[model samples]
Target chain A: MKLSELGEFGLIEIIQSIAEKSQNPRYDSWRRLLVGIGDDTAAWQAGDYIELATTDTLVQGVHFNLNVISWKELGWKALAVNLSDIAAMGGIPVYALLSLALPQDLEVENVTDFCHGLAELANQFEVAIIGGNLASSPDVVITITIIGFSKSNRILKRSTAVPGEQIAVTGFLGLSSAGLKMLQKKTTLDNETTNILRQAHLRPTPRIKEGQLLLQRGVNTAIDISDGLIADLDHICQASKVNAQIKIDRVPVHPLVKVYSLNQGVCRGQLNIIAGLPGSGVIANAD
Target chain B: MKLSELGEFGLIEIIQSIAEKSQNPRYDSWRRLLVGIGDDTAAWQAGDYIELATTDTLVQGVHFNLNVISWKELGWKALAVNLSDIAAMGGIPVYALLSLALPQDLEVENVTDFCHGLAELANQFEVAIIGGNLASSPDVVITITIIGFSKSNRILKRSTAVPGEQIAVTGFLGLSSAGLKMLQKKTTLDNETTNILRQAHLRPTPRIKEGQLLLQRGVNTAIDISDGLIADLDHICQASKVNAQIKIDRVPVHPLVKVYSLNQGVCRGQLNIIAGLPGSGVIANAD
Candidate 1:
């Protein structure tokens, strides 16, 4: 029978039936588990430190368009995005778990390729894919949650940002946004620009190490640039209850973007469109 | 302006605008921030222990059909599924970030309800809605990444089950799947059963406390039951390099599920269809 026929509860029972079979598995130090999978809560001996856990998700049409993005890119981005989160906290990324909702008819090759892309990034990031959950859904949805570790003293939080610290960013901005535009416009470009922008869009390079460096220096408050700088910074500000002023000039934009904007006769405001966060107000300094 | 006009980078810039006007910002004490953003490799701090992270996504057509699920339920589930990941590991959930993609023309109230749902869950779980990205797309997508902390040595991995360990589960299973079936079949149900099944689907509880209990009690290796029992258990077996035997008769199935299945004329595998984890091979006795 179709999944719909089995209904939600039926499907869950099927899932629980199988899930119940997982049993207690893993390392000797953390090995002997009293609670396996049959309870409302679970417990492990954390010892003296706080538990570091992180989760991320990728939607089919939103995060990726199968037609434009390669499985490898999709896989890598999926992992990279999450890794970036751990990095923001001044912590080390250890294990990863993926929850995937895929179209029933997805090809094995597609999945394998996606895995390869995922592995490539995972390996490079030096993190391992411990396990994950897979299910059939109307669309492809990939969600990954990771467990990381850090001392309660060391874990950086947005609430820790103080008033006087200097604001620093690792890489240039606007390239990924530009590349996205290039893709949508289907605009042809010089090999140089095309390669650069496409790479940015398909495989976003998350700032992982920089986060660690900041944390080691004891910069306890941190955040990743998943949302644009303004919005992400807004989070830090809101959490810390502080105010900040950033020069429009200090913010970086790609060279080609300016040229493209000029060529397209787009206003400075339009150029600034790549600067806001979700649910954020209008972009200031459009010029 | 339409999102596309902002170009991907341009849109990000727009979002960044939200973060720009913060009250205070600082970048110091970070000794090893390798690649923060706009770079090839991201390097950050790795203290004495490792870090954990994960991601999950819910889509309009895939995870829920607005016609059946209330906006509140949709929002609740969006965060609930991610929290379930943290509970699966027996970890204490701390912070969460979101990435939502919505089609143009959605009503403001709908968006507010969604946010309300997310905030309520986060508050209830004590998980902070730290930061996330957003975009516009044809389909509505909600992606969330949760960050939590656990002791390094005590962390559980899926590959740790011992040969003789017991397999267990928390709360009832198969209820959501059963609910989905009824919805799809368009079958009528008593208000009581409908409420139970719908609640099962809408606000299925996360096993946070149970997982924590198990973790504290030394349950090291585990994974959540997002997929059916058969599939998730297979992961444990594969990871642990061992086989498990669980009694089908010993398995737990909700009473309401039994009633629904019987009322629906289920037999054999269908007995627990309403809230059953079916097609999962059951071992005679897991002892």
Candidate 2:
């Protein structure tokens, strides 16, 4: 029967029944490791460490519009988003598992290309592709979960922020938002600026190396820029029991961004232009 | 401007501009780490251990059709599918951050309900709701990335399977496939079977505990069942440089599955049904 007729749950049931054979491989042995599949969370004791985990799912037409990105570009951007999280916690990345749900009619060639794109980036970062789930779905949905290690002493957390810490960012801003405008208006961008903004949208380079460096150097209280700068910083402020002072003018807009803002018809400084509402919407009070 | 107008880069540019502060207590030391926002992946070290990370996307119409699911159930399943990947690696679950894209017309109530459903499952699993992203789009899509940890010595990898190790699974089989049949046919399940299959579909219990147990017991090769059994097991076999001798008769079937197969007009034997391949979907030679 068609997927619609089966309904989502019904389809999941079909999938689950087939998977029943895979349970309890190491069951019944005491000290057989402490976690199993039946609880709210899985735990393990490896010498001095116990770690936590989960994954990322960015859906098509939802997280991003196809008309907004190239397949290669999308592949890179999707993975980068999660890497950013690990960076937030002062964790270095070690492993990753990716799950893809694509419509049947999607081009097979594109699938291969997509994997190649993701793999190329993963390889550069030394992130191992540990294998993942591939399924036929109605849309292009790629979900990934990464596992990393911390020395137990250094896993940074949101709750640990202090009230007096300074607020700072690494690179220029407003490029990606500008890229979105270009896509929507179907305007042409020069090679340099196009490359700049494209990198922002298609390939968000999470500050992995820097994050690790910070953690190693004893930096704590951090978050990556998945949400807008002000919003994410607000997270630090709130979690740390402090209110942040934002020098909006201090925001580091890339040269391309500054140019795009001035040359393009789109208003660059407009607060509403930011996706996470850096100074508006839900996070308005944040900055 | 709408997201599409932002193109890929433009959106990111604006995001960078607005996100400015971080709570990193170590910020003074790693003035360099001031930006864990790398070009793609973040490289941070937790204590002495390093982590690797990334995320992917899923969408409706583009990913799954919602008419086939209750909104609340969709919320549960969306996260479940991603967590399944973490399980595949025998990793621990810890925190999650979300980036959701929804059409403006969708009600705040629907959004809240969806979040409640997702959060309930997350909290139940001990996976923290650390942070999230919200945006406007043509479809309703939620993207989440969960962070987890593992020690180098204890991690179980798909590529690490040995040829002679016994391969096994955790739970029953074929019920999900059967449940889909029931839903498509609009067939009602009695209260008992209904409970079984409905849970299978709407809220799949991730095998986190089992994976940790496997890892603790030092079992090296494993994967979660997101794809069909034959398909998923084949991945292990191929990666491990071995062919499996799966006893079609050894796989378990839930009691509800047996009842449904008998009365639901499908060809089946108790053992074969238990092993999945209800209607000759499993080939004798392939076995």
Candidate maximizing TM-score: 2
Q: After TM-score superposition, what is the CA distance of residue B115 in candidate 1 from its true location, in Å?
A: 5.0
Error of 2 at B132 (Å): 6.7
Show where candidate 1 strays beyond 4 Å: A1-69, A73-106, A114-122, A125-190, A193-287, B1-55, B78-91, B111-128, B144-194, B208-256, B271-287
TM-scores for the candidates? 0.59, 0.60
Instruction: Give the Cα error of residue B120 in candidate 2, in Å.
Output: 7.1
* lDDT, candidate 1, A42-97, per-residue tens: 21235454445555567777677888888878888887777777667655665565
Question: Can you give the lDDT of residue A278 in candidate 1?
Answer: 23
Candidate 2 chain A TM is 0.75
Error of 1 at B59 (Å): 3.5
The native-contact fractions of the candidates, in order shown, are: 0.05, 0.02
Highest lDDT against the true fold, candidate = 1
For all the predictions, what are the DockQ values? 0.06, 0.06
Please, what are the lDDT tens digits per residue for candidate 2 over residues B1-287?
A: 43333343343333233222222234321222211321212223454443323343556765455665667777667777666655655555555555565666665545555656666666556664433444455556566665555544344555456555665667777666665566556788788787667667666767777766777776766655555566566656554566666676676656677778888867544223423321111111000
Prediction 1 TM-score vs. true: 0.59
